[model samples]
Target: MEDRRRLLKALAACAMPGVAGTALATPASAQPWPVKPIRMVVPFPAGSSPDLIARLLTEKLAAALGQAVVVENRPGAGGNIGTGMVARAAPDGYTLLLTINGPLVTAPTLSRHLGYDPVRQLAPVSLVATSPNVLVVDARLPVHDVREFVALARSRPGVLNYGSVGNGSAAHLAMEQLKAAAGIDLQHIPYPGFAQITTAMVGGQVQAGFMVPVIAMPLVTAGKLRIIAVTTSGRTSLLPAVPTVAESGYPGFEAISWQAVLAPAGTPAPVIDRLYRELVAIIGSEDVRAKMRAQYFVPAGTAPQSLRQTMASEKVRWDKVIRAAGVQPE
Candidate 1:
């Protein structure tokens, strides 16, 4: 009986440390994740809308999580370079991506050999914001509204040229979609970058082009460009006087440039959910919303499932538009 008691006591003693270890594990370590800085990669230049929105949200996020959120610019390949980087990054919560509509939706459609599958290789964190594309013309253009612009382009055909930020960019596709919908044939002149397109539009190098509201609003307000139509489902608060393309004639025309946050595809569910919770909070904050509006963007914080649906729908729609426009990949 004594030997049996000693054996039982020894077994109990052996199990004590294991039970205590489990109990004594620090819950703070598990709960207080993101002990280090978070890096957000932006696939565009510094002053671009994506960069502006990223900085705004990062500032708030950093403050909330007690970690520094740094933005790194990785512009190239029409946003593919940076996007690819994020798609190939470690699934840890530290690395993330901030990208616009083209990289997330249109690029996958246009580029047959994209290195990463946007839907399958990246986990959508949140929809940051979106800006309507504004159809802007040189201040010296002869047309004042969409009706006259279409008439003038139809009359001139291939003579009246329009500038695009790049060949497969959203701006280019928006203009092509408009042309297809309106049955007007304007010459497409591609520019190396958005800055050049703005310069060309302002200098009368190209008669008109489709640009994000943030990019063209200053030009319009300063009287360097004329806003004829906005490519949104409805009129924008920033440019309430401008008519939508649908209202102009084509009843279902809408082209918007949007941005979103994503992490690598294999990121753990725990990490993804945590990041998403924080992101939704950051994006929906009054300060972040105001900053986005000041940049001529509408706050759009969508869940991962919602973004997945958006990607599927947008891919189908943009594919048809690109095919109709006869856009060949570079």
Candidate 2:
């Protein structure tokens, strides 16, 4: 019993005011945060939008944090592998998750057997950006507008198909949400990645698809695909001519994939606050804004509490859509 008491005293001493204060203050002047390179785990393969953003953010964060911020891709099982890894990783503010909507919100509701609970295992630090999906159809499609497309899909039922980046992906869920709201019956086709979605979409294999504007915009400009509407709350400045789906008659319709930084749950509040402060500084820079604009994402550096609220609201929203669509884990 005496030995146990001594051990407890030793642990308390380590966290005491003077000792804890010194250790925490060591990373200031003549010192650097993350004396070693930090790793940003991306749950998708390279070249994908999320992966590209992760790399961009890593470069910027590395510069801002005065350490190399490396990105590691562990793509598999619809992003479950990498996401689970970060969820169980050390909460020392060194390892972080740079990802989009799936692993954060959709995966938990869809994959009932997933190893980690997103809400319980991770905490949001900062929101990087928000990107809306663009609704585009092959040039050969008869439909010309959102209304016409809805009519055609309703008439054809399962004949006309829409492609998404992958099953349970943000694109898929967006389309599912659209279908429910419009009461249309279009067939859903899943692709392995955006590359396949592009190929199939341009070749007329899939009549329509939901893809990021940056990617589909080039095809639309090339006359390979015709963009019908922007699936966001307001018209995108990039495509000023395209009307938003909400304006097209679907009230309260909005689907956006937000990228953000997150640390594992149980990370000390001070650590989270410090990281958030640094990230906000970096994200607010004009250089980072330029990078985000180049990638077709709107810069949105929200507070930690605001990001948490957004996540909770998003979970509630997607949970309804997933359940209504009868989507289940594979």
Candidate 3:
């Protein structure tokens, strides 16, 4: 018995170094988080605003993190498909979603059966950028400003039609908000995407619509479209001469589109912190700011908590607008 006890004690003592070595080395080995390439899912088509922003940041992020950041376009179902992909992705910081306000804030209220809950399944990393929508009309239209447009609409109710990217899109909601505030009747024409909406507007299929500054400015400059008013409370630098919808007649009319970065829920806090820091740095940098400004996107790198608050507040805000607009889920 004595010999057996001594032998057992000796074996136990011999195993201590190996056990301790593993316990100490495990965390060290895991310290470098991005051991592999990271995939950023842009829940919009390539060349879309959100995708452009993602591609803009990919190289910087890759350089900073020492890993290849791949931007994948997965556009479908008003951005729900790609968003759901990221929501269901593993919470290891390997996958992320860079999207606009439509999917994160408005879609839940618009769709009855979303596969993933953004608030519950995704973690906010940063609010990347924001840009106001420009209300533009076909150059052939007689109206030149918001009031003129309203007058024309009132005179020819339902005769003047507006096109939007989709039913629940920001463009659609902005028009609905305008209709409610201005008490004008205009027909709503829903298109599959922005390209189609631009085509319809140019072809005179629709006389007017709200569009992003990047798309509207070129058309306006080319005499294909005319900018009547911007959606934000203040005029954009891109269209400094154009008045705002609020200034045109309505006082509190403001509908700004924004983009943000998010990860699957349960992502490590440290990883989230690192990403937030890097993103804020990148967004706030002069070069990135210049690029964003060239695209008419206002650089905004809000903290995660602020973004969360914005999400909650926007939900309440859009809910009222959508309900007031009488937009029902499809």
Per-residue lDDT of 1-330 in model 1, one digit per residue for the tens?
999999898767655767644555656336656878989999887777778888888888888778999999888767887899999999888899998878888887677777988888899888878889889888887889899999988988888889875556788898898888878998888764567778887777788998887788788889999889998898889779889989988888888888889999988887778778888988788987888888888888888888878878888888888998788777
Q: In candidate 1, how many Å is residue 175 off?
A: 0.4
lDDT of 1: 0.83
Question: In terms of lDDT, which candidate is strongest?
Answer: 3
lDDT of 3 at 224: 94
Q: State in Å the error of residue 301, model 1.
A: 1.3
Worst 10 residues of 2 by lDDT: 24-33
Q: Model 1 reaches what TM-score against the true structure? A: 0.87
Model 3 misplacement above 4 A: 1-25
lDDT, each prediction: 0.83, 0.82, 0.88
Q: Taking the tens digit of each residue's C-alpha lDDT, what string does model 3 give over 1-330?
A: 999999888777656778755666677676678899999999777777888899999899999999999999987777888999999999999999998788888889888888899999999999999999999999998988999999989999889889876656788889999999989889988765666777888898999998788767777889999999998888777679889999999999989889999999999999999999999999989999999999899999989999999999998999899999788886
Q: How much is 23 displaced in model 2, in angstroms?
A: 12
Arrange candidates by TM-score, descending.
3, 1, 2
Look at candidate 1 and tell me the lDDT of residue 110.
75
Winner by TM-score:
3
Q: Would you estimate the TM-scores of all the predictions? A: 0.87, 0.84, 0.91
